[model samples]
Target: MQTKDHKVLVANRGEIAIRIVQACRKLGLAFTCVYTAEDAASGHVRIARELGGDKSLYRVSSYHDANELMAVADDAGATAVHPGYGFFAEDYRFARRVSQRDRKLIFIGPSWRVIRELGDKINTKRLARSLGVPTVPGSDRPIYDEMEAEKVAQSLFEFQEQQGIRKPLVLVKASAGGGGMGIEEVYDIDLFRSVYRRIRNYALRQFKDEGVLIEQRIRDFNHLEVQVVSDRSGRNPVHFGTRNCSIQSTGLQKRIEIAPGFDPSSIEYGFDAAQVLRDITQHSLAMARKVGYDNVGTWEWIVTRDGRPFLMEVNTRIQVENGVSATIARVRGQKGVDIIAEQIRIGLGEPLGYGQEDITFEGVGIEYRLIAEDPDNRFTPWVGRVDGFGWPERPWLAMHTHVPSDDPYDIPTEFDPNLALAIIWGKDLAEARERGVEFLDTLVLEGANNAGEPLRSNVRFLRDNTGRILKF
Candidate 1:
C-alpha cells in the first residue's frame, strides 16, 4: 500500500506527537494533531499549526478519552491513528476499537490480539518459557491460592540460595498492574504472606483482578531492551538493536539511555557483552515471531553481572528512547533511520522492504531525558514557569522538546515534568561521553515557581552519570 493514501491522527502529546507529525510529513502523508487546554502552549501545538495549518489541529477534552480521540479522527478525516508510546499506545481495547469501530481506522501499533496476548505478564512469561527463552525463575502463571503463592516464594528463596545468593528476595506483583505499582519485595520468606496479602488486596481494589505473579527479584542488573519492527505479515520481524537503560531515578524511571546496550571495547565485563547482546536480540526476535508481533515494540530484559539475561516484559508500542537506537542504526547503508515513520508505513499495510542482514550499526548514541525536577531531593517534580531554556546546537546532537525558547513556558503540573530529550552521537564511547557532558554543561535552563523559588533540574545528575554510560 502507498503511504500517501493515508492520513494519521496523532493521538498523543509532547515530543512524541511532534515526531509523529514530522514522520507523517516525511512519508508524504497528511497528518492531524490533538491538544488540550493545558497543553495549548506546548511546542507540538505550535508545530502542528505552523506545518499542518489550523485545520490539522484539534482541541480534545482528554488524551485518555477514546471517544474523544475517535471523534477527532473522524472529524479530521484521518484514516489511521498513531498512539505514540503512552496513554492508549498499549491499550488493547483502544486498539480493538480503532479497528472495529464503524469508521475502522488503522491502529499504528501491534494488532489487538498481539497486545492482549503479551500485555499479561504471566502469559508473556509462559510464552517465553515455551520457546526456551530465559525468564526470571519463579511461577510462570499467576498464583491465587495463598498456599501456592507461599510455595512459589519458598522455592524462589531456595533457588537463590542454591545459586549462592546470600540475601535472597522474592517479588510479588499484580498480574494486571504495571509501571511499578502493585509490587512488593520480601527479604524473608517468613514475612512473605503478609506482603502477599497486602498486594493482593491492593490489586483487587485497583485492577479488579487479584491474580498475582511471584518471581525472584534480581538486583544489580542492567536493564536492556531490544527494538523490534515488522509489517502486517509478522513473518519478517527484524531488530534495530539493544539499549542500556540502567541509569534511572529513585522510582526506577529511566533517565539516561545508551544504544548498542554494551561497550566491550571500552569497559571490561565479567561476561561476554557482545554475546549477551546477540543472545538477547535473538531471543526477542524468536518470541516476536512466535506471537506474530507486528509493528514496533520493545522487549525488555535484565542482564545479571555474570551475563545471564532474563526476559522481563514486552512494551507493545514504540518506546520513548527509540531515538537513541535509531541514532546508531543504518538500514541498507542509509543514514537518518526514523523508526516511527517505519512503524506508520508498516501499520498502514506496507511491507518491510528490508531484512535483518540489511541493517547495520555504528557509533555510540546516548539520550538524556531532561526533566524539571530536583534530582537531589528524591527526584521531586519542579512545577514552575520556565523563564529561559536554550542549548547550543551541534551537528551530532538532536533535541526534542515541547518547551518553546522564545517564550516563558509554564510546566504543567498534571503531567510528568519532562522538559526535553537530548540525543548525542559519537564515533565511540569516549567521544559520546565527552559530547554528552559538553551538551549538559552549556545548557541554559532557568525557571521559577509560584512561590518565587528557583527551578531545579537533573542536569548535574545526568552529567555525572554520563561517564558511566555502558558500565555494568
Candidate 2:
C-alpha cells in the first residue's frame, strides 16, 4: 500500500496531536485533526490550517465522544485514527469500533485483542509470571473474598519482613481502577481490613467491581520504563532502550524523564545499573513476543534500592516521554529517530524492516515536562493566559508544545496544563544536566490567571531536580 494513499484522523489535542500531524507529513501521508472550542487557539489547530487548509480540521463537542469522532472521520474521509497518548489511546472498545465499523478504519496503536489482553493487570501479571518475568509480590488475580484478600496482604507483609524491609507496607487497590483511584496504603497490618473494606466499597460503587489486588508496597524505588516497538507481524520486536522516570511530583506524576535508565558512566549506583537495564529490557521483550505485541508500547518497572526490578504494568500506546528515548536512539547508525512515525508505519501494516541489532544508543537525553502548575502547592493547576512562551534554539535541544509563542494563549482548565516538552541531548550525563539547567533557566514562559496574578510554573521544580536525575 502506498503511504500517500492514506489519511489519518488525529483524535487528540495538544502537543501529541501536533507531533502526529508532523509525523503524518513526514511519512507522506495526508492527515486531518480535531479540536474542541476551547482548543481553537491551540498550536495544533494553527499547524493543521497552515499545512492542511480548512478541510483538515474539525470541531468536536468533547474528546471523549467516540460517535463524534467517527462522524468526523467519515466526513473527512480519514482512513485511520491515531489516538495520541491519553483519552482513547488504550481503549480497546474504541479500537474495536474503528476496526469493525461499517466503513472500517485502522486503529493506529494495536489490535483490539492485543489491547484487551494486555490492558488487564491480572492477565498481564499472569502472563509475565508464566514467562518467568519478575513481578511484584502479590496476588496474580483479583481477590473477591475478604479472607483471600487479607491472606494476600498478610503474605505480602511477611514477605517484606523476610526481605529485611524496614517499616514494611502493603497496598490495597481496586483491580479495576487506575489513575491513582481506589488505592490505600496500610502501614500496619492490623488496620488492613478497614482500608481494604473502604477501597472495596469504593470500587464497588465507582467501578462496579469489588475485586481487589494486594501487593507489597515498594517505596523509594527508581521507576524505569522499557520502550518496545514492533510491526504487525509481532514475531520480531525490538527495544529502543530504558528511561528513568523517578523525578516526579508528590502526586506521582512524572515531571522529568532521562533516557538510558541509568548512567554508570556519570553516576554511581548501589547495584549493577547496566545489568538491571538489560534484565528489564529482556523481560519486556520476552513478554511482548509471547503475546505477539504489534506496535509501540511501554513496560513500566520499579527497581528497588537493592537492584531488584519488578514489572508494574504496560502502556499499550505511545507515551508522552517517548521522544526522550528517541532522542538517544539510532537506527542503522543514523540519527533523527522518530518513534511516532515508526508506530504509524507499523500500524499501517508495513513491516518493521529492521532488527534489534540494527538499533543503537548514543548519548544521554532528558525530557522536562513543562507545565503551568505551582510545584510548591501540591502541583495545583494554574489557569491563566500565556502571554509569552519561548526558549533558545540549540542544536542539541528539541521542544514540543501546542502553546503558540506569537500570540497569547489561555491555559485551558479542561485538560492538563502541560505547556511544552523540552528534550535535550548531550555527550554524557554531566553535559545533559548542565544543558537541562541552562534550558530551564533561560526559558521564557510568562502568563497570568484571570485574577491578575503572575504565571506560576514548575520551572523551578524541574531545575531543582536536575542533580537527582538517574541517581538510583
Candidate 3:
C-alpha cells in the first residue's frame, strides 16, 4: 500500500490532469501538474494543487517533448508519475526509464511490455486471436512494402471470395495511429492500391514507422468502447459498460462528436458486447500480469451488423469520456476516480472496501468534449481566450474547463501552438443531454474561430440530440 505522502508528478497536460489530480486528492497523495508555457494557465494546473504545482517546465516545442518531461519528473522528487492519456502514456521507452529510476514511479496503468505488444496493431491482433477473442478481419501482420501489401491484398480477395464476396471494401490503416488518424477506406482493389500507396507515406511521417494493417471496412458501424479495470493480481477482472462514438463528421476539415448516438436501442446489440469486453479485459489483464500490469485502462471495440464485436485497440490510460461512464456507474455510487484509487490500492498491495461486482452502473451520463475550434470554415481548429463563459442553473451539469480569466484571449489558428478542452457531464441520458445542451448554450468563445464549422456543427448536433448522437 502507498503511504499518504506519495508525491506524484503528472506527466501530462489539460483536462486529463484535472481528473488525475482529483484522484490523488481523494487518495491523500500530494499531486503535481506539469505544463508547457502554453498550458501554464490551463484549468488542470488550477484545480489539483493546494497552491498549484510549484514546478512547471518549458521546452523548445509545445508538444511531445518526452526527454524534457522525464527530466522534470526526476527533478520534482516525485514518488510516482501519472501519465494522463495522450503524450507518453503508451510510450514504452518512457515507462522503462521511469521504472529503472527506482523512484517507485507508478504507471497508473499497464506495463511497458503490454504497451509494446498492444501498440503494435499486428501483434495485438495476434494476441487477440490466441486468446480466442474476435478481431477485425484484417491482415495478421503490418504490411512491410508495396509488394507485400499487394500480396496481402490478393490473399484477402481470395478469402472474401470464399466468404461469397467477390469484392470487399477494405480500409488501409496505420498501425500506430489513433483518434481516427491514419485511416483510409477504399471500396475497390484499384482504390485500395491508390489510397494505400498515399497513406503509406502519411503513416511514415505520422508514426515515424512503416507498418500498416489491411482490414475490412465496416461502414455505418457504431464505434463503442468498454472501459475496464484490472490489477496485477489477476483477480476481479470486470467490464464497466460501454460508450457509443458514432457521431463524428464525414471529413477532416470538419470535426464533431455526439453521445448516446442516434438510437441507443437500435444498437442494443452493443449490450451483448459485454462478452467481447470481458475477453478484451481478460486478455489485456493476462498480458499485463505476464508483464506486471496494473491500474485503470480501457478496451476499444467495434460491433458489426452480425452482432459480433471486433477488437480495435486498447488505451493504456483513462479515456477522455471516462467521466461519463463513471457518472453512469455512479448511480451505483461508483465515482470514476474511485475505481482508479481502488485499483491503485490493489496494485500497491493495499485493501479495498468491496469486490468488483459490488460496483454497478446507474443512470446515463453524457460527456461532451468541447474543443477550441471554429464551427465555420469547415471546422478548422481555432483557439482564443474565453471572453465569457458561464453555466446556467441547470440540472445534472458538471463542467470542466482549462481557461483562466487572467490569461490572454489570443486568437488561435489551425496550427495554434496551444489548445484547450472542456468536458461537461450529466446524469442519465436525458438529463445528461439537457445539461450538455444548456452548458454549450452558455459557452461563449471570443478571439478566434479557426475550426468554427466543426465546432458549431458539434454544438448544434448536441443541442439537437443531447448526447444520444454518440449512441450510434
lDDT of 1 by residue, 295-396 (tens): 999999999988999998899999999999999999998989999999999999999999999999999999999999888997888999999999999999
Per-residue CA lDDT of model 2 for 1-472, tens digit only, reads: 5767889999999999999999999999889999999999999999999998436999999998999999999999999999998789999999999999999999999899999999887899899999988887788777899888888888888888998888999888898776555678899978999999999999999778998988877899999999999999999999999999999886678899999899998788999999999999999999999999999999999999999999999999999999999999999999999999999999999999999999999999999999999999988889999999888899999999999998999988788799999999998999999999999999999988889999999999999999889987
Cα lDDT tens digits for candidate 3, 147-167: 888777767766677777655
Worst 10 residues of 2 by lDDT: 175-184
Off by over 4 Å in 2: 139-155, 172-184, 189-214
- lDDT of candidate 2 vs native? 0.92
Per-model CA lDDT versus the true structure:
0.92, 0.92, 0.59
What TM-scores do the predictions have? Answer: 0.93, 0.93, 0.81
Give candidate 3's total backbone clashes: 28
On the 0 to 100 scale, the lDDT of residue 459 in model 3 is 54
Better of 1 and 3 by lDDT: 1
lDDT of 1: 0.92
User: Which model, 2 or 3, shows the larger lDDT?
Assistant: 2
Off by over 4 Å in 3: 45-50, 53-63, 102-104, 157-167, 251-293, 331-353, 374-379, 383-386, 393-395, 405-408, 411-428, 449-457, 465-472
Residue 273, model 2: Cα distance from true site in angstroms:
1.3
Instruction: For candidate 3, give the lDDT.
Output: 0.59
